[model samples]
Target: MTSVTPGVPERQAARPASMPVRCPSQVCDLDVLPDGVVVTDATGVVTAVNSRALAILGADRDAVLGADARVALPLQDLEGRSWWTCADPYGGLATRTRISETLLALPGDREVFLTATLGRERPRGPVVQVVVVLRAAAARRRAEQKTSALISTVAHELRSPLTSVKGFTSTLLRRWDRFSDDQKRLMLETIESDTDRITRLVAELLDVSRIDSGRLELRRQPVDLPRIVERHVEGLVASGHAADRFVLQVQEPLPEVWADPDRVEQVVANLMENALRHGAGVVTVAIAGSPGQDFLLVRVSDEGEGIPEESYPMVFTRFWHSTRRGGTGLGLYVVRGLVQAHGGTISVGRAPCGGAEFCFTLPAGAPEHVA
Candidate 1:
């Protein structure tokens, strides 16, 4: 057999301490550790404990010491069962086998959690003592409840706009012949614009889920950078902005970029939409070619009221809007993600046109031949 270490004692020789340290008179004297600690004897009688334990149990040291420890700190199993079958599920004092356990409050009216372990001095002896640590469980539960409420509120708010767009589109499509050519075109335009708005909102919702799940995917393809820019701007114009309201400045003989075509379109569209919403008169879409750099630099500028210098960096963050306009505030968030997927960068700043400017970069290369 191996020899025992100097500090180690055999189970047969270990005995419980009958005496406990009397807590000081100072009510402010609490233990350094957040958890309240309690030391008990082998027979489960209370011995020594910190002031935190005293406050946790709402009892004086004289009233607790030498009493059955289980009367102050009880033990519970995983299923929350008590030592006796008739005990209240939460009322009985019980130490949990696991590190995290929720228990009922004493007279203090605050929920308490007890974490305990069996401490032994000898291998063969009964657990000579059980040390129980206490913490309040109410704070964590409150935080979780608040987060659940926020999610429910956001979901309910989003459903209204989506329902409006869906109902109008379905109604128009079902009775196409009942409308005149001009009416038909107007209804079609409304349906198309509303559908775009709905799509953007749904995409934003999915982007949030993708970010949480780590499943954002970008499809890289050979795309004509300038052509995509012009197309997106034109489509956005059809949505609201007139053709003459925005100007395009793309260098001739533009290079094809290695990018996700649809995502790239989303980036350009979001920037242009932001410009139209925040800017005053003219919005310029500029594409400059960087020959040796293997990237195409693009800038979307508007002549509206510029953003404050301090708010520049926050524009791309999720649900950030500096203005009072009715927007879901996810446009720039989606833009940044799409730009990053192409291994590109995007930034916002004051535009020379007295508005806000959004700039981004993408790879510049000739279209690759497909099989």
Candidate 2:
């Protein structure tokens, strides 16, 4: 542990026996703070240091407490000037000034870019303490990067559907008299399909916002799992997916599930669509009652190349797509959110057919009474 400089007041000596110290807020407890905190006297001699500060500095609490703030922190401005000299701490300037473009060099050869704010605890007191708060610059940069990527992705996804709709509509309007009935019908269908695609993309974006704000809601009711699965398969076929490509298997006398019917359908549809787009061979949807359990287990499996074990944890994260052209990168994230809202657990694994398998369990409805 780094040792604090000598001549500083000990923890007991800092406070008078007559006066008790009280924390004004939970943040006053330095241990719970996410950012590093260091307190120094007006002359820049360290008086107190938080655990986070010690960890960030890679020094011991005792070593930092009495040390000069400049030696312990050694911050440098963007122009390579010492932050302590430039800031002029001992001058009559207020301690509340924000320090920007500062770099802190740790003892272990690691450096952290940071922004700091300095404030005084007692402005007119004889022994004033300057409080410094440190925030990591790298974290902010990462957040900015993610925001830029999301904007780019949204623009790209929206442009494709909009282009298709515009091109089809323009062609039909210009060549309406020359087109036969079949050609007009085909163009109209294409436009409608493109419109549906745009709607789905917008809906997924809204769901993501709702999930982030903790406002995702579910209306739970008794739902027939097998029926929902069968209906989704049929809908896929109607949307041009080959009917023979899907296989549905339901265990005999399976109990109805306690879930939101619409959300359950959404989950099944998303998983089926993912399988159709990414997997090879027949896609299988299976539902079975868990023996001696109150949940019904459902699995959507495909015979395409299986997902790597390392990638399983990230599959359900928002904006993460396995392929460059995958839809919106929000399908699995929304599916997981809906399943969890219904008191269910979902997981991904290798199927028996050597491909990706998504398994989820939903609460079973009340059991029927025997006559």
Candidate 3:
């Protein structure tokens, strides 16, 4: 799902087989860090530099450790202004603490962002040392670009539905007596559907923010997942799908799950919608519980052209839809988040009918269920 927000350690440098891998903290283990670190004295003289910092700054360790901080690490903002000259950690206000993370350019086109933690004896006191934490800015910049694209796309998507709703309502209001009952009903129904779309888009934005911020929470309750699926199937039929196109297979005596009802329905709705919209033929939903009733598994498949194996990984990522339209493209991402929040996993594969199949699971609930 686009709105749903969501790693490994760096490999150590190869060492001689006989050499020990121990990092002695007493001698300062800063060299083992993946992030660049540079520590300077109050006078802005470099006191210590890590191997990562040397690599990032492209400066020799011997030349940098005892050299002037400004001379050792020449950094400038986009406008070519010196970073140290602007920061002035020692000359700035006594109350000033750490320098916030900033993007700066080095010689050539290399870019790095760093933040300095100011060590102080007391508030508004003289600075002791500036501990600058540094990292390559390429990944962060890429993330910013993606965020901007998603925001632009979401805004564009929201506009279309809102414009339709406004147009329909305004027309109906201006010519109320000119329309027949059936026509008016149709217009109102269209508006209602558009309104639902707008609501879902807004909810997706909020869910994405929450998921990204690690604040997305589940209102746990005993959920009849199969019933939820059945209700969604009914909704699909009501929305104009043929009844026979959908087949619901529930392994009776299935266990209930502890999940949020809205989230549970959202997962089902997204999958069923994808099956109908992207895949061809009949849609089949199969539900069963794992051994020991620890978790419940739901598999949704279609009789259409299944997703290619290569695109399987991209299916659950934000805005991954290459051809599909009329969606924020965040459904599967949000579904993945919801499923994962319940300590479960979701996967994609070819179905028995040669169509795409999505399978997800949820943890079992307690006997004293809410609903």
Candidate 1 lDDT by residue in tens digits, 263-360: 88878877887777777788888988776657889999988888888988788875678675557666677778778767789998888867888889
Candidate 2 collision pairs? 2-60, 2-63, 3-62, 3-63, 4-62, 4-63
Lowest lDDT 10-residue stretch of candidate 1 = 83-92
**Highest TM-score among the candidates is held by which one?**
3
Error of 1 at 354 (Å): 2.0
Candidate 2: tens digits of C-alpha lDDT, residues 9-78: 2233344332323344532477788888887764566766678778777788878876788788876665
Better of 1 and 2 by lDDT: 2
What tens digits encode model 3's per-residue C-alpha lDDT throughout 1-371?
Answer: 22210100112243224322333462157888889998876556677788899999988888997677777888888899888777766657878887898999999889999898887656787676678888999888899998998989888988888898999999998999999999999999989988898888888889888888899978887788878988988887897889999998988778767778888898898899889888889899999998888889999999887888999889998987835565778888888988897788999999987999999988787535453
Per-residue lDDT, model 3, residue 48, is 79
Q: Top model by lDDT, which number?
A: 3
- Model 2 C-alpha RMSD vs. true structure (Å) is 5.8
Alpha-carbon lDDT of model 1:
0.67
Tell me how far the alpha carbon of residue 192 in candidate 2 is from the true structure, in angstroms, after superposition. 1.7
Q: Which is the better candidate, 1 or 3, if ranked by lDDT?
A: 3
TM-score list, all predictions: 0.57, 0.79, 0.81
Better of 2 and 3 by lDDT: 3
